[model samples]
Target chain A: MTLDFWGLGLQAVNVLILVWLLTRVFWRPVAAAIVARQTAAQALLSDAEGTQAKADAALAEVTKAREEIAAERAAMLASAAQEAEVAVQAKMAEARAKAEALVEAAKVAQGHAAEAARKEQTRQAATLAVEIAGKLLARLDPNAVQGAFLAQLVAAVEGLPEQDRAALTRGGTLVSAAALDDAGQARIAEALGKMPGLTFVVDPALIAGFVLRTQHVVLHDSWQSDLDHILKDLRHAA
Target chain B: MNSPLDAVALFQIGPVPITQAILTTWGIMAVLLLGAFALTRRLTLTPGRRQAALELIVTTMDTQIRETTGAEPAPYRGFIGTLFLFILVANWSSLIPGLDPPTAQLETDAALAVLVFLSVIWFGVQGGGVAGYLRSFASPNVVMIPLNMLESVTRVFSMFVRLFGNVMSGVFVIGIVASLAGLLVPIPLMALDLLTGLVQAYIFAVLAMVFISATVEDGTPKSQKET
Candidate 1:
């Protein structure tokens, strides 16, 4: 067996040179590439994480703003609803008051209309009674109706005051519902205590009995006159 | 056929006689250098298929170194990776007609073993210091220092013998078979030699890495004392 130290030395030197060359060409460049890629990836990941954080922050802000808007909207809606309710109540009260006033006015007008109608009816009844009495007296003996009226007139003259009787005794005109016969005039004048200048005037509206009118007094003793006095008393009472 | 132990000078350069093994070694170096240069020409961050393939090779080497040493692969990567590549290419060069693998020669194998021995010491010194590298021999106790020192030389010598013996035997066996059986009979043996060559290259590289890392780790605690 043989070993060559010279050859061994040469081979070792060659391998060492090869290792040096390959290191420069292969190992360093490739390792640098890997390291560069890793660094770039880390940078990209950091940027992405930063962007995600920003996005999350923006989203949170938006959510908070939306919540605030919703709360404000709810508050405004509640306020508006309260105001609307108050307005509705006020309008309702006003409408109720107006309705009551209209009812009161309608009741007053109805009462007035009822009073007018009752007055008209009463007046018509009084006129109807007077017309019926005139017709009834025309059917009766005229002298008997005159005698009954003369008795009423004599009672009314007796109840007169002495001063009023003295004033009524002065000259006056006699108004009769019809042309007065001498006996009717004498009866009315005797009941009136001798009213002077008494003239008998015929008035169809007075119907039959005589009415003596003096300067200060007048005496009525006729069915028509009696009915007229009754009608006037009913008007006053109504 | 020449003896497997013989390295006949094919030529001479001044006082230095150049053997076939040396010539083949140079050719292998040229091919590796050119190929490396060409492959790495257009390296980009975004790699194409060629770049991906180159990266895969480098990444695999780094991974193997990292796994084996448990230290960073950068300092050891160049020497270990080149050693493996050169050995593998040299061993497989036997596939060429009438060409013997340089690793089959005693000188080449011895040179590789010597380089491994030197690298162990270098990395040990680099990881610690000169005194720390020397202190690696005293691991466990000072009593075993002499044995550890002897074991270090013998271990490197054993590596040289193992590589030379395996490659030389395979080549010699194939040569004997081809000479006796008149060619074609050595084909199967040649195929076996390919597997053996690949295994030897892997073993040499792994053993070199282990020896270097072991020394570095062993010397580390003593490094502070030396510093």
Candidate 2:
């Protein structure tokens, strides 16, 4: 093999030139492109992260608002229920009060009507008793009624105290519904004593009996008494 | 007859005589430069088929550099890639009829070796500074400094001789065999020659990587650095 100095020198120059050219042409641009693409990818990832955070925050707010609205609705429903309950209670109470008042008014009206009926019944009973007594008295003989009343009057005069009978003999008149004959006058005089003047008063209002009037004492013995007794009994029964 | 051992002169420029090997190197350089320029002129974040293929090639080279050097691939990428491509193209040029591989010439192989030798020194000094790089020769002991220096020169010399011998022998054998054996018989040998050429190119480039990486590897030899 032969060594050529010129060939070696030329070859060296060519290699160096090729190295410089390739470095300029190929390496720098490819590296720059790769770095730029990586940077853009990183930026896109960062933007996506930010958007996700915003969306999450908005969703949280919406959830909270929905919860609040639900709570408000519940509160309103509770309030409405309470109000309705109160209104129902008030209405029931009012209805009860009105019913009680109506019952009281009806009771008062019934009492008044019962009182009026009792009064009317009492009046009718009194009038019927008086009419029945008058009819019984009209059927009786006048002499027998007069006799019975005169005997009762004589017995009552005899039963009087000595001092009372003695005081009645002074200036007293003997009153009667009928004119008494000598025997009746004499009998009454014997039982009572003659004093001052003898007076014979005929008062038909006494029916068929006698009445005594004295300064200190008076006495009743008449058919009208029997009628009063009958009226008293009938009133007690009614 | 034996083929001529010397590179033939094609032209001259001033004191420099441009040879056939130099002219062929220029044609190869032009093709590579134009292709690179066109591919890189309009680049995109999204790559086309041609661009994707090109990136695949570059990525593979970068991965190989990292595995070979155990250092970042950025600083050494351009020079090492250029060396591999130039030698690979030169070694395979013999496939063209009447065209000889430039690596078969001693001057061309010598020039490639010189470039690798210089790059090793440059990268070493850049990595460890001048004093630190000089101190690397005395590794294991100060007594080994002279031997280490001689080893450095001889190893670069071995690179040039190895490339020149393999490619030249392959071409010579094919030529001699074709003259004696008929045309079709030498085809198999030519095929074998093609395989040999690719293997030799790979070996030369890998050896260059080892020599350069040795200088930059924590400013120590590969054996000591591993230890």
Stretches of model 2 off by over 4 angstroms after superposition: A49-238, B1-3, B11-15, B181-194, B220-227
Candidate 2: count the clashes: 0
TM-score of each: 0.74, 0.59
TM-score of chain B of 2: 0.91
lDDT of 1 by residue, B1-227 (tens): 76657899988877777999999999999999999999888788888998888888889999999999897898998999999999999999999988888999999999999999989998999987997788788897899899998988999999989998999888889888888998788999999999999999999999999999989988888545466
> Taking the tens digit of each residue's C-alpha lDDT, what string does model 2 give over A45-135?
8898898899899999999999999999999999999999999999999999999999999999999999778867875777677666666
The DockQ for candidate 1, computed on C-alphas, is 0.57
How many clashes show up per model?
Answer: 1, 0
lDDT per residue, candidate 1, A6-49, as tens digits?
Answer: 89999999999999999999878888887887889999999999
Q: Runs in model 1 with CA error above 4 Å? A: A40-147, A156-238, B14-17, B42-46, B165-199, B222-227
lDDT of 2 at A177: 69
TM-scores of chain A across the candidates, in order, are 0.76, 0.58
